[model samples]
Target: MSCQEPEFVTAEDVGGFDDLWSSYGFYNEGCFEKGAPLVLNDQQLFSDFAFMDDMHFDSISSAISVAAETDQPASNSELLQLDEKSTPPLPSKTSELLSKYQFKFNARSGEKPNESIERGGSKLSTEDFMRIAASFFIQLSTHKDCNPFMLNNQFGLSFSGLSSAEIMNVELAILLFSAAEKVSQQRFDHGTNLIKECYKLCSKTGNSVQRVVYYFADALQERIHGGKGTVVKAQEVMKALLSNHPVHLATFRSLPLEQIMQFTSVQTILDNLGSAKKIHLIDLSIKHGLQWTILMQALSNSSSVDYVKISAVGTSEEEITSTGKRLTSFAEILKLPFVFKPVIVSDIKELKEDMFKIEETETIALYSSMDMNTMIIKPDRLENVMKVIRNLRPQIVTVVDVEAKHNSRSFINRFTEALFYFSAFFDCLENCMRGDERVRMIVEEDFFSPGISSIVAAEGSERVIRQVGIDVWRLFFARYGLVEAELNQWSVYQASLLVKHFACGESYSFEVNGKALLVGWKGTPLHFISAWKFQ
Candidate 1:
């Protein structure tokens, strides 16, 4: 080993081999001779027929969707658009109706309004805060403790009592509870009054008891005023992938989400491959290169293959370069000759055959872990790309996609679906991510917020995070002349082990849908992993 370089044993020393091959030249010059476009082999049919299924953004609508919960029906008139005409006057009987509830406000029993509250208005007491908070929490689909917590709903938000700040929290919570159309609309009207009052009291900053006034203020502008809070920089969105900013770390490290599902992605490619002299894997989008490292170690443990080459493609040259270096280090640790190819693509139009260099008599596999479909933003481009892929004739192509109806063209439909989808995601975090409030906030603010913001606020090319379900993806692949291939049963068994290993056995479940596996929390599907071969 060189003085500066890290030293490691040969693959043979660890895996019962007598010799290890040296790193060959990066590209296979011999196979550059282009072959005529290969025809889709129809003889490779696996399943006869199968069914299928289906992120956040920013915008005026996105703003409301993010800060304002949509438990009520939303409409152009009903939605609080600040620039629009003044919101309707608060219902005269609203306070009276609310007083009928079992609130028992701690307004000194015999005193008048001014004696109870300095401002001479009927301000709610600390107990009132808990009652209000409980109301909205009960309507939540996420939050594991929603029901159990509701059993003892008498908890206080602030002992002193209500302020515009706490009122803002209550208003926000009301929006969060997804109620029926009529109820949601009613809540929107009531919440609008709270928004107005909160802003009116904004000048008296001291009265804003909740320490986080700006958060509430921002949401007010976004939700009630139809304000698109802030335009998120594209780089910031991508940076979230690496940021240890609580959100990314929680998502990047945890179980049933990033780590375990990532394990499933790697195993999908490794399972049931016959002996070959060399292995070539092409990743359409290598955000972290995590799966490759896990795969490299697993490959090192086996004596089946000799050379491994990884061609990583992404929008960032830096990420691709970084991933290459990391993969190279792992390969060296196993004393294996590994090649990492970095392909930078600024647009889907940049995708071409030249990005992939075929090697003579080598086994090739393609992976699009939560990638590919995202790049197919248009029909013509998607078709052309599929044509390009069809020409590669890879041994297999593995795809993992988010399972939600989040890609609809209609903004209303997309926004509505996002609420339900992310609610479940948050619930997963709450039940599964105990003692990690900071992580949850990060995931919600930085990760979920930005994503939701993009989906809600952005349009056209800015909306790159659009995702569709696996069933739709099956049809998409079929157009390229591909069929779903069953992941080996061993890989299926590994799925259960991954859950148990994560110590989240009770929190997650897996289903083998034909050859595809749907791994999700409780009964809700989060992601699907399936492999494909020529149809």
Candidate 2:
């Protein structure tokens, strides 16, 4: 929740593009940071418009297709060519590996959504709105596979049913804030006017709803103003919202679009283990531990894994305890000697070699699915963290990170990249969650909305939303002397299996760059999972 200011020495990169790390957006402070007004004089010369790979996005993962060979830096010609045509329909195959473990999603809407905000929502009977809200929360918060747009039509419908325009304003505020990913300017403009009306109507300056509304207004406004977000305000509102509606945070579990890849990466590390006695799975950011359950089942099925132990680290002690107990119960059921060691840390930085109590003889595998890299604030921090990890000498360090370059100190470049990345993402969501507006609302409110705001608004260490390509991580690992272990064929196949089984019509492509497996929708790299070993 708090940011760690990782200090780095200013080492200049004079010959920018030719250097390996240049395209990856890992440069010294002097080379990248624009003091106040975004000045990227040096970076501008080396800059190329970064966009998707040879990606043609469709409705679901089935329709989406990727050309794995196209990892080239983007060009104007390519962009122009891409602009002219619709997403090229690419073919995908359903492998046998998908049948055993597949994450599925289908957008189901009871009634079709309306055309626009111009035509106001249909009126509902008195007190029916509460039932609707309850239904929305249950179906969305509970089910991982629910379509995001499940309640899309309810936005205007809910507004129409409210007794006072004041409550309607509040509802509009929530919808507009959540729908930033795929709403038109006209709808956004109408929501803006409603927000202004709420300010005029409601007297409570400290009201929680008012605060959330204003905070989202600021966040959405900042994105419109070239993606410079109101970070402090956004975080404050986010903290407040989490305090009031705790379940909002758990919305991620319902939609396990990428969990299959994460588990595969963990299983791959587990598979690589030799004849070690106690195999320790060190999960840096273990949330709910459901992903671990999948790996545990795999381990239980096999007679090989004798004593499987885990060190589950998380920000929430309650979550850790519950996950630990859950795993222990499963292990008891399986009758395997499994030890669940749950560690509570305020920050992931607290996760160092000293925190781990593994015996010298035990084999350890570090599993970080979409979190460990964010702990790295700067190059110096990475080096320091790498030292700790290096000391631990984990047999394999599995990492998964977003592909878009969000690390650029320069605002303009960072904003542009984020916009491009999210646009494709929104389009993908639209295709996948087309009819399910209700599910779309939850996904946007809990996940994508915050991501957009955080990336666009926050600066420096506060901008933990930063993501980079695999090459950058390749450099960091290589620099720290951690040997890159290419994700195995089985791991890659597992990833492809998820896409094959669950992608609906969306196509997902997996490519290997050196020692990393890059998984992207259409052609743009969404997530990259890699493995490393200590030299």
TM-scores, one per candidate: 0.59, 0.57
Q: How accurate locally, in lDDT, is each candidate?
A: 0.50, 0.49
Model 2 ranges with Cα > 4 A deviation: 1-220, 223-229, 233-256, 301-304, 378-384, 434-436, 458-464, 503-505
Q: Mind giving the per-residue lDDT tens digits that candidate 1 earns over 195-283? A: 44334333212221221222233333344334343345433654455322334445566655676666766777787356765898888
lDDT of 2 by residue, 416-510 (tens): 45544654454445445555556655555555567667765565556645566666555445434566886767766665665555533234556
> TM-score for model 2?
0.57
Model 2: lDDT to the true structure: 0.49
Error of 1 at 467 (Å): 2.4
Candidate 1 wrongly placed segments (more than 4 Å): 1-250, 301-304, 376-384, 409-412, 456-464
TM-score of candidate 1 to 2 decimals: 0.59
